[model samples]
Target: MSGQLEKIRGLKYIGVVELASQAARILAEIGTTQDRGTVSEMPDERTLRYYLAEGLLSPATEKQGTASVFGYLHLLQLLVVKKLQSEHLPIRKIKELVDGRTERELERLLGLDAKAGAKNEALSYLEKLLTSPSASSPRSQQFNSPAADMMRPVAPAHAARQSAPQQQGQATWARVEIEPGLELHVRGDYAPPTETKGVRRLTRLLLNALEGYRGNMRK
Candidate 1:
């Protein structure tokens, strides 16, 4: 139902030039550049490939590749970050600008906000690509299922903890159900169970897992 979901479902083959143009336009609209430049300056094929390897532009996988005009998007984000830095916008403020706007709306702002939008879009697109049927194989699907299945024991763990006496000077543990069949056993040595900190730690762990998964997928 989201615009990103729609794009992922409906996207077909788009030319490299067309992709570049679209990315450029979005960046320009978001105010990534003060001069309102076009995508003409985007790197050529070889340079773009290098950029992708460097993680400047996220590399497209086979199934959801779509000819990869990500270089333009990356460049736009960099330009916007630079512009925002020059304007003395704090990181939080810049993040707020990006978080508050849709991709199209951010494009209209044309600065740090636009850069934020670009980064968000790139990440979204990457997720779609990674999750698409074409990007994953049967084995990967199986691996993912086990990871999901790990959550089943969490409810019992929570129930057991409820009946147990709280121990002093012992690490506290929480069982979190991330999704159906996926649960995390979060252990912390600090006093006062701050759910926020647990969630942050879990999120970081998941991100690290995803990064490794992506790397393995690439290989």
Candidate 2:
């Protein structure tokens, strides 16, 4: 009907006005700089143009250079190293923090263990792997191959696998799973059981419980 159409049009106009007001308020707070003058006032086309030119309003981009390119885990490791450095912990202490079972476990311990034993274990493994003869060169040692650089130990694949099941199970539980027969009857891909009638019933039950609890508390 014409009346219904007019009501819908009025709603749409109200929504557009609300959105424009919010955007204008946001722009007014964060004043822009332009060629004419610094915008301590409300934004217009000029302020938007200046922001685009300065790359200040550009879309998010990926982090580049050594840290990110090496590995995300390595970047996290570097952050941990920096924190340890600030605390004035020695190299051996820093290594222990990295190799510890947990951060909490390391924080409890005060004494430094034997550094020679740790270094020797690491050196022995590296020596065997590096000195092994390759098909390309009989005399040359493969100490610093590209493959070695890429061979940083990944987190246990099982850890990643365990997280995926828990996340998916949570999503599944939260969703309303309808039977195919009822789904067809509702004429939608998925139909929620919490319809108007169900909601009214739930609201009544909640109100009744609240009133009963209040009466009991007063007594």
**What is each predicted model's overall lDDT from 0 to 1?**
0.45, 0.34
Q: Tens digit of lDDT per residue, candidate 1, span 1-219? A: 123222433343243444445544444444444454333343344544443454544344333354543333343443343445446676555544443244344333442334466576667767865665434566654423323223332343444545663743333354444432345554432233359988788678787996797689778
Question: Model 1: residues >4 Å from true position, as ranges?
Answer: 1-15, 28-31, 36-47, 56-171, 174-186, 190-214, 217-219
- The number of residue pairs in model 1 that clash at the backbone is 10
Best by TM-score: 1
Q: After superposition, how far is residue 109 of candidate 2 from its true place, in Å?
A: 15
What is the Cα-based lDDT of residue 78 in candidate 2? Answer: 31
Sequence-dependent TM-score of model 2: 0.16
Measured against the true structure, the TM-scores of the candidates, in listed sequence, are: 0.30, 0.16
Residues 1-219, model 2: lDDT tens digits: 223222322221112223234335433333322334322333343543343243222211233442112222222233334345445666555654554233222222211123354465467556754553222243332332222212321233224435674442222111111211111111111223368998888668756975696569646
